[model samples]
Target: MPPDALELLSEKGSAERALTAALASFQEQVQAVPSLDLAAVVEAAKPAFSSGIAFSAQLVDVRGRHKLRVIVMHAGGAEVTSEEWADEVDDLLQAAGWMLAMLLGIPLAKQARPVEAEIAEAECLAVVGVPDASAGPEPSKKEDAAPVVDLDVALEPLTPQEIEATHQRILALPQASRQALTKAFREHFQVPRNARSIGDRITQHQHAAFIDHFLEECEEQSLDGAAAPAEP
Candidate 1:
C-alpha cells in the first residue's frame, strides 16, 4: 500500500474512535439524569459526521413531555490537529448534557457547573478574541426588552367538538380537582371566571400543557387516596 493511502486510513480510523468515545461519554452523562427517558434516548440519539465535524440528535422525554436536542461538534481546527478537535468534541458533549438536563426540568449536578462556565468562556472568546485571563468578567450589555403578550391572541381557536370534549373531561373530575384545575386555567390565561367559554379559555396551543398538568395532579391525588368527592 502507498504511504499516502496508509496515512489517510489512519486518520479515518482515529476520527471514528474519537467519535465513538464522545458518544459513549454523552450517553453516560445523559443517563445519569433520572427523569430522562432512556428508551427514547436509545432510539433517537444517533451520531453523524461530515467534514471532520460530528453531529448528534436525540428526543428526550420527561414526565410525558418530549423535547428534541441537536448537538454539533467540530473536532478539526484551522490546522490538522487531532488534540484540538478531540477537546472541542468533549466540550460540546458536556455542554449538550447540561442543556438536556435543563430542558427536562432536572437540576444540574454540581460538577456540571464547569460546563456552563466553559460555554460562557467560549461565547466571550467569540466576541472579544482572546480574553484577559486576569480581568474579572465584563458586565453584559442591557438591551430594551420587548413587552410580553398573551399567547391566546395568536393561537387558533379550538373547534366546538374539541371544546365540548375538554369541558366534559374537566367536569368528569372530582369537584375539588375540577375547581383546582379551573382556578389554574383562569390564572394561566388571566380570564375572568365567567367571561369566556371553556373552549375560548383553553386554546389549541395551551390545551396539551393544561390537560397534562391536570392529569398529573389527579394522579397524585389518587395515589394519596385524597380524591375529592365527585359532583352529582
Candidate 2:
C-alpha cells in the first residue's frame, strides 16, 4: 500500500446488524473492486490506483461473550488471515475504518479512542513525508508564465511500453486464440493494410481486458468439453 493511493474503497458485509451500520459510515469511490465495467477500468494498469477494499465481518462467541471480527480484502483478495477483534461494535468499526485507510497507505489525523491495539503518537499528529518548504522555488508570476513540469499528467493515453507489453501478452495466447483475438480487434477497429497490421490493431485497441475475457471463455469452454471460438 503506497500511503497516498486512494482509488476506490467499497464496503460490503455478511452480518447486517451493527456491522452493516458501521460499514455504511465508510465511503466508496469509482467502481466496485471485484467487478468493474470498461469505463471504470480505464487507465487501471497501476495496481495502487486500481485496487479495491472489501470488509467482511461476522460475530463470534468467545467463551460466553460475543465479539465482532472484521476481515478485510484488498483488490478482491484477502491479504491477511489474522483476526482483529473489538469488544464494542462502534469501536470495532472505527478500528476497521482506520485499518482500511491504512491499507490504502494513509493514516487518519484524528484516530479513535484507545483500543487494545497500540496507539502510536505519530498517528494522532500529522506525519509529513516531504515538507512543502523543501520544494524548490515557486513559479514567478507573469502573463505567459507556466510552472515547470517535466511529465504530462494526461497519462490516460496508452504509452508505447504499455502497448508493447499488452501486445506481447496477447501474442502469448494459444495460436488459434491469438489469431481470434486479432480478428476481434480488427472488427472492432479499422486496421490499415500493412505487414504489421495485426500487431497494429492490437496496439490501437489497448485492451488487455478483452484478452483476459477471451482467456476466461477458453477456460470455461475447456471445462464444457469443447473448444470455444472467441467472439468479438
Candidate 3:
C-alpha cells in the first residue's frame, strides 16, 4: 500500500459503514428524482460547449472494499476550438463525474479520480458531432454527422505494466500451476488485484473476505512468535 493508502485505512471500517449508508441514501434520492437520467444528462451536456464527448461508470475494489469509480469516457474532447469553451466543458464533465459518484455511494479523491468508463462511439471511433437537424433534412451519412461518444478514464489500483507483467507470469506457467498460486493467494494474499494480476481465473475463485481471514491468521501467528520464550 502507498503511504496515502495507509492513511486512508485509518478510516477504513468507518468509511465502509459510511459508504453503505451513503449508497442507500443516494439510491433513494435517485429513485425520488422526477427526471434524472445519466444518458440524458450526458446528451444534454454535449452541446453546452464545442467538444464531442461520452461518459460511463464502473465498480472498483480499493483494499478489499467495494468502491464505485467514475470513468469520464473521453479525457479531452475534440480539439479545443475555444480555450474558454473547452475549459467550461471540462469543468462540467468533472462535476458530472463526481455527481454520479455521490449518487452511487463512492468517495473519490478531492482532486480527480478517473476510472475506465464503459463508453465510446460504437465501433471504436470518436463521435465528431451532436446531431443537428435544425439546418435541414438529416444527412443520409449518419456516421459523418454524429460522432460516436467515447468516454474512458484512468485510475490507480494497478498500472498497465504491472497488470501485463502479472498476466505474463501466469501465462508462462501451466494452468494447474497458476491455479495453485491463486489458491494460495486466496488463502494468504491481502493486496488489491493480486489474484486479478494472474488473470480473472484467480479472482473468480478468491473472495476478498477469504484474504482478510488469512491476514488475521498471519497476524495471530506473528504475535504468538513475538511472545515465545527464547531457547538456550
Candidate 4:
C-alpha cells in the first residue's frame, strides 16, 4: 500500500480499523517468501504505475460480513468488475490479490497440486490450448487433436469466439469450489486487452502461464486460497 493510502486509512473511524488490519495481514501473506528480504522487496515493489491495466479494489464492512468489489481497468478504456462477500475480510482480500496478479500478468511459480485442484486445472487446460493437458495419451490429429501452443512464439490476443468458448468451459465445472476458481482464472486470462502494455513485460506468455501457475497454487493453497469457505 502507498504511504498516502495508509495515512488516509488511518484517519478513518473505528469501523475502518478492520479494513486496515485486513490490508496489513494481506500484505504479510503476499510477502511471505522467505528467500526474499523483507524490507527490500516491499520498498521496490510499490510505486506509481505509469502504464498498462490498473486494478482498483475496495473492501467495505457489511454488517459482520465483508464485501469486496474489484475493478480491472484496461488501457483501452474498457473495464471488468466483479463482487464477492466473505465473513472474514482477509479472505476476500486474498482472492482479490490473486485476481490482481493474474490481471497484471505476473508470472506464477510452479507448485505441487492437490488431487482435486490438479483435475480441475487439467480440465481447464482443455480450453486454454495447453498441449494434451489431459493426463491421457497425446491427442492425435485424426482424433480430437487438442490445440498446441509453442511458448517460444509470440501469443496473440484472444478472439471473441475463443473467449466465449473458454468461458463456456469455465461454467461447466461440476462443483462450486472448482467453478469459483475457474471463474477467476477465465475472467483475468481472457480479458481482451494489451496486457504487455502494462507494468513489466506482461506478454501473452505470462497470461497463458498464469492459468497453469494459479491453478496449481489454488490446489497448493491451504484451505484452497480464498475461493473456498473457511473450514469450521
Candidate 5:
C-alpha cells in the first residue's frame, strides 16, 4: 500500500482499539443504572486521502424502543501531525461516548475518564502542514461591507414576539422530536444558543427556506407516527 493508505490504516486501527476500550469502560459505568442498556459499533476503515474522519454509531435502549443514529465528522488534512490526529480521533470517540451517556442519562464527565487516558497515549509519527497566517491578502473595507448591501433586502431582525412564538412552537414538540429539531437547527445555522431569531444567523430568504424544510420534516414525522400502529 502507498504511504498515505498505510497511515490511514494505522489511524483506523488505533481508533478502533480506543473505541473498544471505551465501550468497555462505558458499559461498566452504566451497569448501576438499571434502566439503561447501550451498545456501540465503530467502523474499521478510514479511507485513504480522505480530508476528514467520519463515523456512525447506533444507540438503542434495552427494549429497543428508543434508537438513535449518530454520525460525526471532524475536518482536517491527511497530513496532520500525530498529536492532532490523536486529538481528532479522541474527540470523535468522546463525542460518541458522551452522546450515548446522555441518552442513558449517565454523567459523561464521571464515566469518560479511563478511555480519555487510553486515547491520549495512542500517538503516531506524522507531519502537519500549517498555513502561513500572514500570507493572505489584506482585508478591504469594500469586501467587509459587501455583505451589508447583499443582505439589506434579504434579512431583517426578528421582533421579540416573533422570537417568543418560535420558542413556544419548539417547546410544544415531543422530547425526541424537539431534540432532533434543536440539533438540526443548530447545525444548519451554526449559531449560538442565545441566537433566538432566524435572521440572526441567516438571510430572510434562507430563513424561509429552512422553515419550509423544517415544517415538511415535522409533517412527515406526524404522518409516520399516525400511520404506525399503536404499540402494545
Candidate 6:
C-alpha cells in the first residue's frame, strides 16, 4: 500500500474499510453464529480477552522509524504460524483493535492499540538562542521587568530502608485492618487525581489490605476460640 494510503488507514478517515478488512480474515474460524452481533460479541469478550491484545500487539517499524502497530487478538494457539502472510495479519489485527474500540463506544483517542513511533534526535533537543544583551529597546526607566528564575528539581528513588520499614509495618498489622487501610488509601489518595504512577501507591495500599485480611482472620480465630455456650 502507498504510505499515504497506509497513513490514511491508520487515521480515522478510512477506519471502516480498514476495520472490516482486518476482521474479515477471521470469518472462517470464528464462524457467523446465527443472529449473533460480531461487534457485540467482541465487546462482551473484552474484559476477559483484552489483556492478551498487548501480547499480540507490536509496533512495526521500517528501518529505524515506526510504520504501523499490529495486534492479533484471537489466535488458535501460540504456535499459529504467520510466516507467509504476516503483513496481512498485522494489518488485520490493527484494524480489528480499532473496530473493537469503536463498537464499545471507547473514544478513538483512547483506543487500546499499540503505537509505532519514531522521533528525530535533533528535534528532541531544546533550542535556545543566545541572549543579545544590547539589541532590545532600552527598558523604561520607570518600569522594571519581572525577575527570571529557573527552578531545578531532582526526583529520588525510594530508599531500601523506607521500603523495608513500610513492609515491616504492614506485616505487623492484622489483615482486616490492612484491607481497611488499603481501601481508604485507594479511595482517598489514588482515585481522586487519577494518578498514573500507581505502582508505588498500590504497594502502599496493599500493605493496608494485608493488615485488614490479618485482622479478619484473627477475629474469626477469636470467634472460633470463644466457646459456643451450650449451642441450642
**In model 2, where do residues sit more than 4 Å from their true spots?**
1-155, 193-195, 203-206, 226-232
Q: Count the backbone clashes (under 3 Å) in each candidate.
A: 1, 1, 8, 1, 0, 20
Worst 10 residues of 6 by lDDT: 116-125
Predicted model with the maximum TM-score? 4
Q: Can you give the TM-score per candidate against the true fold?
A: 0.28, 0.26, 0.19, 0.30, 0.27, 0.20
TM-score for candidate 4, residues paired by index: 0.30
lDDT of 5: 0.37
The positional error of residue 215 in candidate 4, measured at the CA in angstroms, is 8.7
| Local accuracy of candidate 6 as per-residue lDDT tens digits, 2-56 | 9998876556434433333333333213321121133534544354353232124
- In model 1, the worst 10-residue window by lDDT is 77-86
- For each candidate in the order shown, give its overall lDDT on alpha carbons: 0.41, 0.36, 0.34, 0.41, 0.37, 0.33
Show model 1 residue runs off by greater than 4 Å: 1-156, 193-199, 224-232
Q: Model 2, 1-232: lDDT tens per residue?
A: 5534432222222222223223223322221222112122222212333335344546678887765454444553333222333453334544443333322222122223333211222221111111235335742222122222234432244544454455445433433344455555555445543222344333323344444444544444444433233469
Superior by lDDT: candidate 2 or candidate 3: 2
TM-score, candidate 2, is: 0.26
Model 5 clash count equals: 0
Superposition error at 208 for model 2 (Å): 2.6
lDDT of 1: 0.41
Q: How well does candidate 2 score on lDDT at residue 180?
A: 57
Candidate 4 residue 82 Cα shift, in angstroms, is: 3.6
Tell me the lDDT of model 2 at 203: 31
Q: Write the per-residue lDDT of candidate 5 for residues 1-232, one digit (tens) a residue.
A: 8999999988866665444344334433332222112222221121210324444465445363433344333333121110112222324344344333332223212133233232221210000011235536743522332223246544664443343234334433333443455455566667765332222233244454444455454454445545556669
In model 2, the clashing pairs are: 3-105
Report the candidate with higher lDDT, 4 versus 6. 4
